[model samples]
Target: MPSYDSWPSPTWKKIIEEQLEQVEQMPRADFDIMLKKQLPMAVYNKELMTGDTLDAYLEPHAGSLGKASFFSHQVAHYNAKYTESYGTDLPKLKVPVQILWGEEDEWQPLMYAKRLVQDIPHACLHVIPKAGHFVMEDEPGQCSDYIDRFCNKHP
Candidate 1:
């Protein structure tokens, strides 16, 4: 991840905004194609998904124009809002927090996990090897085990 101050680079933000603008007008078939193209970046272990699993992942993304637009908006404004607030907000989190990050995440790099652990007082970071942005999808068993252990320790 880029520094919070420079997150969502101007070029990337422009591209996402343009995508959001066209999403409402896109046909469902075309949107599905776009999702298909994007799937690889989301997971590190491609072998984990069968055709049926791929279809299952794409299913909920149908009729998701609103969701896409909302996500785009967040990305567009992350530097403006989230960066300014997280400095103050993160340390306020009093409860134990587990940050399960994907070591191979393309969208958010491992450096972010370090930054987050530094920012939050009660947060511990776990980096799952061979996992991308979709950690649970790339390594479901490891992700679940981490979650279970976190819960057991915290509870």
Candidate 2:
């Protein structure tokens, strides 16, 4: 179970609320622009967060306001159960767990990775450098290598 002391920052809450409120009134292009501006926070490499990349990332999400609404609804209700815990269940996971985490993740702190490693009996963590929340985007080669190695080892 992930810690939720300050999981969703005020900025994320505000963004979700803004998306929910303005989805109908705002132009789709304008909403995309507004959302694209916030996308860089997920990536450590600012240079990789180009206009084309942002557009591509947003394309899949563009057709579904319902998806956005569902996420917003979840976020709205998250606070009510933030403190819920499943400490006893984590150790019961018998499968091998490989946690590929970003070293510079701004959203999820490194402590979560440490906590998970401690909780899961057959778990290992690999903190990829020069990566943020979107570790694969930030360091695709490293992410691919780690995932391939994990899969091969487990299989």
Candidate 3:
């Protein structure tokens, strides 16, 4: 994805600022609310989040993820540094590369995967069908299989 690009062409700071306000205003830090609000955007399949998976996943890292300042710093850092690194320098990688992406990812679509593969030498992209940004959560078996295959090929 293009650095600091969006539908409205707003910088990363603006988006994070809006989210920071929402996080502060929420009545509870409950995972359920987050699941209802953000999970659809994160996960491609709701079936993968059944039982206590979301709770278990969030409980361990809730504190750090809940921090507004930390999030703001991350957004700023990424927007500031990404263009110089990933956007511009990605093609410099010489080692074998495998891009494992969710095919249904709306945030970063298959085009980004293709772009990465095209730019990086010895790079291949594997798209996990019916999966979104959280590909591991949506299709753990396929994700793991692709990773194992890639590692084995590299090794």
| TM-scores, one per candidate | 0.76, 0.77, 0.73
- Compared with the true structure, all predictions reach lDDT values of 0.72, 0.72, 0.64
Give the 10-residue window scoring lowest on summed lDDT in candidate 2: 1-10
**lDDT against true structure, model 2:** 0.72
Ranking 1 against 3 by TM-score, winner: 1
Model 1 lDDT tens row, 11-113? 4466566765675466777777766766767688876554987888776665666446545554445554566556667777899988888888777778878
Query: In model 2, which runs have C-alpha deviations exceeding 4 angstroms?
Result: 1-6, 15-25, 63-88
Tens digits of per-residue lDDT for model 2 on 63-146? 557446535564456451454355557889999999988888777788888888998897999998889888888999998998
Q: Candidate 3 — which residues are off by over 4 angstroms?
A: 1-19, 29-35, 61-65, 68-84
The C-alpha RMSD in Å for every predicted model, in order, reads 3.6, 3.4, 3.9
Point to the candidate with the largest TM-score.
2
- What total of clashing residue pairs does each candidate reach? 0, 0, 0
On the 0 to 100 scale, the lDDT of residue 68 in model 1 is: 68
Candidate 3, residues 1-155, lDDT tens digits: the string is 44322222243356556664665445545534654555456578866655587666555435645444334554335453444356567778889988888888755667767877888888988888999878888888998889899889889
- Name model 1 segments beyond 4 Å from true: 1-12, 63-80
Q: What would the TM-score be for candidate 3 when compared with the true structure?
A: 0.73
